[model samples]
Target: MDTAREFLENITAADQGDRVSRLRFAPHKPHAEPSFYEYSVLRGVRVESVRCGSTLYCSFTVPARLIDRNGKLSAGAIASLVDEIGAAAIHKCGKPMDVSVDMSIAYISDAKMNDELEITSRCLGQRGSYHSTGVLIRNRTTGEIVAQGRHSLFSLPATASKL
Candidate 1:
């Protein structure tokens, strides 16, 4: 299946949910405001596919706009991409909206502009209202790991009662 398309569709579907759900998943969309980080920083990023059940595989080329002064991918951009991709993976695993409780990243190496990156995020598991996810960002051409991230999220309970 087209994992990237599914990922984007999941995100868009979440955005079309209830008001509170939209707030939790995409606060910017409800207000009709621009999300610079999502729109600009991650403009060309695409979800390539989903594999091994719930693992989301994505890719994007390093744009010059996201490069740091030292001519490498900025840490902030990397972190944002990890967070967003992690959320997408979590959404695919049944939870469409959640609030991140904890997040951490380990930078392995630097990537320069024009480098293509392959990112993968998988849902580790969920307990009670808490969920755990892991992500890896690698240099597509060199097969080098550029960063790893972990995300912890709390799934909001459904507010409406079942009829």
Candidate 2:
């Protein structure tokens, strides 16, 4: 179909080269400097409390770097927060670091720079090597739910199996 051909054209070699050529790759100045992405995201995050080693409460303020051109917090940033907070809930409960296998998110509202947000994550349950967690992001100022997420991870055994 013409529709399929048109879509495919967008990802052609020429188009791919064009897209890559436009990107600016700038490395951080010093090797000693912390990764910019991690520093930006982790800064201003405050852990308010933890209970049962499976629930966590934290607060953060939307920062300018994470704001999209539309003047709202970027959805990607919200997803990253969900992954971090949700995984922490499981790891703090004495589980080994696991590889995330699935994640689902619902974006309910928008947030602007400097808006305070409350992030809560709790373990739903686990079976075998699988663990599930739920995360909710709420606007602390307006009491509006910004997003909700569910994350699932697969934790492998510490040692290799004979098979």
Candidate 3:
């Protein structure tokens, strides 16, 4: 595990142009520039992994701070999770693009505090102007389908240099 940690640290630290390109698909600084969902420590949410290709997949975990009065993860928090995942996917594109134009989330189950979650996204074919992707939120603890949704991201010409 220490080796893996060093490997990842090296991967992020190396100056290879292409390697930088790969990492550039993610936020400029993920831990430093978190999305809105990161505003409160209410829930523990972290970007677990990322994959970029025809589509993208990114995973986020909810800690437990932002649960509702009912003691479950808040819907707004979940929605933010989806947004962050989609935003991450866009960043992985390695080019500037418009933000999400359309999306629909369906809550399948509820998650409690301290329950780790994994969010998955897949490219679901695309139309001319819009690239579509499907997202899934699952509870790692119980393997419950917590939520599912589809998101449409609009791509535009890069406005500024990604570097």
Candidate 4:
């Protein structure tokens, strides 16, 4: 089996532009059932790039369902987006899949419904079994920052059976 790092490197070695475009068009498989979170919170989100290394980028068009009573994107939805993207970046950086130790988000500005958002996440660093990642969400058209988030994750140890 390929190591996580190797798998990500192979993906990055392919045609990057094509890969990004493909993700842009089809964020999820048509035949697969959406996960509960995806169905509820990420219906209109797209994966812009899943590049190897410590960084990844995604996009979403804010839909009515994700809007708050104040006519802006809901805080909970933004937090969920940040958490998901941060985990993706950590995975690409070769961190073993594990639960989040902590996550924090700071809402900088408001994005109204129908606004397009660009989310960029970067794995800051890792120490032993802990990984840290940062994410920034911005308005796609105006380049205004909407929110910023940080995540700390605990890496799982490889099972003896796998070894």
Model 1 error, position 49 (Å): 0.8
lDDT of each: 0.81, 0.83, 0.65, 0.79
Error of 2 at 148 (Å): 0.4
lDDT of 1 by residue, 13-124 (tens): 4565553353323345632553645676668988889887579998999998789999999999988887878877877344356778899999999999999999999999
Model 1 lDDT, full chain set:
0.81
Model 1 — TM-score against the truth?
Answer: 0.74
TM-score of each: 0.74, 0.74, 0.62, 0.71
lDDT by residue for model 2 over 36-119, one digit each (tens)?
Answer: 555666678899999985999999999886899999989999888888788888883444457789999999999999999999
* Per-residue lDDT over 67-105 for candidate 3, one digit per residue giving the tens place of the 0 to 100 score: 798988888877767765655554544455456888899
Backbone steric clashes in candidate 4, count: 0
Query: What's the ranking of the predictions by lDDT, best on top?
Result: 2, 1, 4, 3
Ranking by TM-score: 2, 1, 4, 3
Q: What RMSD, rounded to one decimal, does every model reach?
A: 11.2, 9.4, 12.6, 14.0
Residue pairs whose backbone atoms clash in candidate 4: none
Model 3 error, position 108 (Å)? 1.0
Q: Which whole-number lDDT from 0 to 100 does residue 140 have in model 2?
A: 100
**Which regions of candidate 4 are displaced past 4 Å?**
1-34, 92-97, 160-163
TM-score of 3: 0.62
- Across 73-120, the per-residue lDDT of candidate 4 in tens digits comes to 999999988877788787733433557899999999999999999999
